[model samples]
Target chain A: MREDFQDELTRVNRTLVTMAKAVREAMRQASSALLTSDHTMAQQVTARDAEIDVLYRVVEDRVYDLVARQQPVAGELRKVLTALQVAADLERMGDLSVHVARAALRRHPAPAVVPELADLFREMSTVADGLAAKIVSALADQDAVLAAQLDRDDDAMDHLHRELFSVMLSPRWPLGVEAAIDGALLGRYYERYADHAVNVGHFVVFLASGKDD
Target chain B: MREDFQDELTRVNRTLVTMAKAVREAMRQASSALLTSDHTMAQQVTARDAEIDVLYRVVEDRVYDLVARQQPVAGELRKVLTALQVAADLERMGDLSVHVARAALRRHPAPAVVPELADLFREMSTVADGLAAKIVSALADQDAVLAAQLDRDDDAMDHLHRELFSVMLSPRWPLGVEAAIDGALLGRYYERYADHAVNVGHFVVFLASGKDD
Candidate 1:
């Protein structure tokens, strides 16, 4: 029975990892859609959010069942509860991707931000995607070290976010006020996405340390 | 032993209710500060957030201990977990109040927005304060009906947030670009606070209904 419970728990983790991967892909696709003003890809990412939502609900139900039936002790209970919270965060991340896609759709055929700003966004997306991947791996392997490294990666995203804001605030960009607002919001979304990934890494660290910090 | 566990859980609930009340009061103080441009009150609210944080951590530790040692089942586990999550939401609400206070500080000696916009913010704060109070009571009493009602109250906040944005977007505001950006961010913060309160209500409904939806 214990082995079966572990198997079920592993299955849930696998689902979460897959969900994280999908979110990362969705983000990349949404960014491309934004750069190219591809309405079709933007719509595709928006539509795919339902899959993330469904997975979230499924994982939540399973975690609740595990707690109820297994009466998970100490480390096991922490793992399940963290998984539940991370699932909620991941689902929200998916929603943010949809938000980005919708914004892309709204401004389609418009000129992109200068190549520099575009590069900054691409770099932000790449860091976020890397952080998401590391979180999944950390959880799967219970690697506290890797999780800690992901936490540091979040700092890089923050720095990039601040840099983006500085650019928006600077007089160098002849971008209109509306463009600046959009850029600020986009930078915020990316920074927040990275923050959530760091949150997941913190959960992993807590599980490994057996202490909530 | 079960009775003792129940009693301890009750203590946790009592502390949570107290913490929620404190947070609501802090939010009220912050709004009053904003309305009056009272730096003292704003500072007071900001200072009180640490107390809320400390209380939240204590409640969190106790809840985890209860779950680990008592091994609560079914309804009991649900109740405990709901309390834990609600505590977290309340803490975040407190943080939001601090954000408002900081904003208030930035605009001290005179109201930040124009009179009409300030009134809108005042109204948002009132709804937010009321929503927090209702969520606390709903959780304390296990009143799903009250919780659902609070959920609807969130709509008023959403409307105000949209109106704030519309005001920002309008060409009428002489404050120009900076005001629009500040208004947008402030509106977003309030909307998110209301959303968290609604989330607390959803958790209450979940506890009462035993269903994820």
Candidate 2:
């Protein structure tokens, strides 16, 4: 019975890793759609978001069932609870990715990211993807050190977020109100995607270290 | 022992209600700060956000202890888990309020909401506060009916969010890129606050009905 419970716990962690990978792919597709004005790709990202949501539901239901049946205590309970929080953070990352995709769809054919700002967004995408990857590694390996590093990785995303705003608010910015608003909201979505990835990493850290810091 | 566990559960619920109240007050202060350009008030709101974080930590620790010690199952376990999710949503609501306050600070000595859009933002603020209040009532009473209504209440917030965007994107919009960006982000912050509130309500519904939908 104990071994069976342990297997269930391992399965839960594996599911979190899978969810993180899906979110990373969603963000990747969303970023590509935005930069290239690929309407079909953007539509695909938006549609696949429901798949991420389904994975989230699966994690939540499994955790509930495990705890109810096993009555896991101490370390085991913390791991189960952390899985739920991590799934939630991953689910929110998927939503933010959809937000990015919709921004692309809203200005279809015309790039959602103007050319001058395109490089900046691409850099943001890199950082976001990196953070998501770290979340997967941290969860799959239960590496608290890797998880702790996400906060520093998130700093790069934040810096890029501010850089995007600086470009938009510059006096020489040629884009008018509409483009500026799009840039602002898109910057927020990418930044928030990084934030959720960091949150999931923190849950991994908490699970490993038994420290909620 | 069961009676003691029940009392601890009651304490957890009460703490969630208190956290929701704090989040509501934070949002109210943030809106006032943004509209009035009250630098001091905005500063206060930003500084006081830690208090909300403290409340969040309290809920998490208490819930963890409750679950580990009591080994609750069935409805009791669900209630404990739901409390954790609700506390997280409320804590995030607090962060969004800080974001609004920061926007006001960024444009200190000048109103964040221009005079023309001031009425719309005020309406958003009212809806945001109302949602927070409903979260409090829903959690305190465990009223699935009241909790179920938050989705509709959130529609009003979504409408205002889109309205704010439309005004900023209009051809005749007088505000420059900076102000438009500010408006876009502020609208998003308020809209997300409502989203978190709705999430809390859903958890309440789940707690009462055992249905996650």
Model 1: how far is B143 from its true place, Å? Answer: 2.1
Candidate 2 lDDT score at position A175 = 81
TM-score of chain A of 1: 0.92
**Clashing residue pairs, backbone N/CA/C < 3 A, model 2:** none
Best of the candidates, TM-score: 2
TM-score of 1: 0.89
For model 2, report DockQ: 0.81
Candidate 2: C-alpha RMSD to true structure equals 1.5
Best by DockQ: 2
Q: DockQ scores for all the models shown?
A: 0.43, 0.81
Worst 10 residues of 1 chain B by lDDT: B173-182
Per-residue lDDT of candidate 2, residues A1-213 (tens digit): 799888999998888889999999999999999999999999999999999999999998899999988988877788788889889899999999999999999998888899989999999999998998898899899999999999998999999988998899899999898888889999989888988988887788888888877
Give lDDT tens digits, candidate 1, residues A50-148: 999999988877877788878777777777788887887788788888878887887776734445588898888889789888877887787788988
TM-score of chain A of each: 0.92, 0.97
lDDT of 1 at A38: 88
